[model samples]
Target: MNAKPRISILFVCLGNICRSPLAEGVFRSVVTEHGRAADFMIGSAGTGAWHVGNPPDPRSIDIARRFGVDISHQRARQVEAADFNRYDLLLGMDRNNVQTLRQRAAGGTLGKIHLFLDYANDRVIDIPDPYYGGEDGFASVYQMIREASEALLSKFD
Candidate 1:
């Protein structure tokens, strides 16, 4: 049997209540489906501390539950300086998140930070924020992450 390389990924957003958690959950689900779940370390965090220690947004949990993905156990937290040394890739939900991460990155962290959609082969688009939108908005964001995560997985194969 061939051993797969384990890659650590950190998904980041503004508050971590919506986008980041959803991206983490969706990306995890995709990797599991591809039988590479064991080959990746996935986590989520926020740029700010507003929602630190809180669970993902209720709306996000509801939307994910509808699609059979569970993000209920995930909690919101701010990205720490130590994360730069821990994760192999730091994925941002949008341009702002990427900028925030870049501003705080130390050492070689800047090179690991990237917009999540940068991996998407066909639809290169940012995952829209669903915090103020409806269920459909969450679903759309999920699809974007799903596609992007698949492309990312391909890169490691």
Candidate 2:
């Protein structure tokens, strides 16, 4: 019997307060629900350093808690250069995030960076940032991330 290799994933966003943290938590929930938590490495990061060392936005925490997942403990960190080669996949929440990752990725690691929603069943799209919006936006983004999270886990599992 052989142990399966873990799939390492890093979810990235602008400030890491809203979208990426939710994505990380959602994916964790999806993997745990499917009993595949031990088969993967999961994390989230921000493209900018403004939110580094800060907890996820309160709205994000509330929305995840509403869905039975707690994201309050996740801290924001800036995406490091080492991250480009550290994870098997670096998923970006939107076009700008993806573009930034691509730009920072070394030539050999380019293929591992992608738009997070590419795993969703529907058309490829960016998960909207909810920082400037109301709670309703957070809820909508949660649903979207959850869908894509489930799809992503299935693809790797």
Candidate 3:
């Protein structure tokens, strides 16, 4: 039997430590829960390099942990030009990040980049950054990412 091709996805944000990491973790958990872990490649990165070589923010780690997902081992990385060619989808947490990805991607790669929430919330096309907010903000962002993950997975599996 022939094996199915994987659906590779990369999540991006201003800083890799917050929204993008959470989206990566939540989407991984969703794929696993759906028994489709072997069907996908999931990762997170930042448009900016400020937090490269770091882990997700403490609050992001905590929020993911509370939901039974451990994201502590994931490191922050910068979005590189090669990423556009490697992943099937490059999703950004907000309009700015989406715009940045589109601008960085070559012409033919444009179709693969989009706002992360566009899969789940067409009206509020973003998963807000929780790095500067309190605990509640992380919680809300986690919920948003989780819902979007499910919605996005629906398209592939």
Candidate 4:
């Protein structure tokens, strides 16, 4: 019998320590809840190199934890050329990240990069970064990510 293929996804933002990590954690939680975790390979990265080795922002971690998801283990990483070929989908948190990814992508790789909220049914197109905002900002981001994650998972069905 032929083995099943896994769908690979990469979430991206300005810095891996914020929105992208939250997206990764939320999406992972959704897939696992649906019992489809093994059917997909998930990861996250950022467009900038500043936080490449740091953990997700403490605010992001706390917000995820409140939602029953743990993102503390995720370390920040900058988007790499190899990632274009590795993931079937490269989800950007905002238009700027998508534009940056497009610039870095080789000819055919551009097709794999897209805005994460494009999958969401809501009118919101961008997930604002809460890195320098208050706790409420993190909570708001959590809701947006959770909604988008659910909508994105529906595409796989």
Candidate 5:
């Protein structure tokens, strides 16, 4: 018998250390909670190269930990041309990140890229960048991602 194919997803943002890593962690937690973790492959990246090779921001890691998810292991990475082919879905945290991915995409690869909140049933259109903000900002971002992650996962059910 053949095994089912795993769906690959990549979350993206301006810098991988913040929103994208949180999104990755939240989504992973949701999937694992529902016993669907093995059915999917999840990861994250950024549109910029600044944070490459570093782990998720301390603030992001702390916020995720508060929610019982550990994102400390996730490292920053710049979105690459090859990623379009590697991931089935490439979710951007905001408009600028989506635009950057669109500009880098070749041909039909652009179709797989979308705003992370696009899957959300609510009216939230973008996941705000919380890099320059205080701890409360990270908390807000975590809530947004947690809600969207649940909505996004519901689509596959």
Candidate 6:
């Protein structure tokens, strides 16, 4: 196998308790399933500090667990300036989150900031925020992130 790229990805949402943690968990699972766990470093954070140090929402954990990905251990945290340096890609769940990311993405890191769906292009796309809806919402979010992650991994590999 080709040596894996030393890539780091940071998933961001408004509150780390929902979308971002799920993205981290889902993306990590994808890399692990392909035996490329050591190829990348995956992490997540919220643009807001409201849920700092808190575990993902119970709804998120339950939904992720049902899909065979455990997100319970992940704690919510606010994005820091250093993350712009730490990650190769700083992907946001949506456009609004992109605005938040841009504020913290000082220096030349703006090039790394992108909408999560941007990678998927016309295929499976748009990492949605499932905070306001039902179980189906979480499932939809997970599916989108999974598909996008797959598309992204293909490019890197």
What's every prediction's RMSD, in angstroms? Answer: 2.1, 1.5, 1.5, 1.7, 1.5, 2.2
**Model 2: runs farther than 4 Å from truth?**
1-5
lDDT of 1 by residue, 6-114 (tens): 7899999999999899889988888999888888889999999999999998888987888789999999999999999899999888889998999999957789998
Clashing pairs in 2: none
- Say which prediction, candidate 4 or candidate 6, comes out ahead on lDDT: 4
lDDT of 3 by residue, 6-79 (tens): 77899999989999999999999999999888898899999999999999999999999999999999999999
For candidate 4, write residues 29-103 as lDDT tens digits.
Answer: 999999888888899999999998999999999999998999999999999999999999999999999999999
Model 5 TM-score, 2 decimals: 0.95
Q: Write one digit per residue (lDDT tens) for candidate 6, span 80-137.
A: 9899998999988888898889877786989999888885454424566788899889
- 78: Cα error in model 6, Å: 0.2
Q: For model 1, give the 10-residue run with minimal summed lDDT.
A: 118-127
Cα lDDT tens digits for candidate 5, 1-157 = 2165478899999989999999999999999999898888899999999999999999999999998999888889999889999999999999899899999998889889888897455454888899999999999999989999999989888
Per-model C-alpha lDDT, please? 0.87, 0.91, 0.90, 0.92, 0.90, 0.87
Best of the two (2, 6) by TM-score? 2
Q: Give the TM-score of candidate 3.
A: 0.95
Candidate 4: C-alpha RMSD to true structure equals 1.7
Q: Model 4: number of clashes?
A: 0
Candidate 5: the clashing residue pairs are none
Going through the candidates in order, what is the number of backbone clashes in each?
A: 0, 0, 0, 0, 0, 0
Cα lDDT, model 6, residue 56: 100
For model 6, what is the C-alpha lDDT against the true structure? 0.87
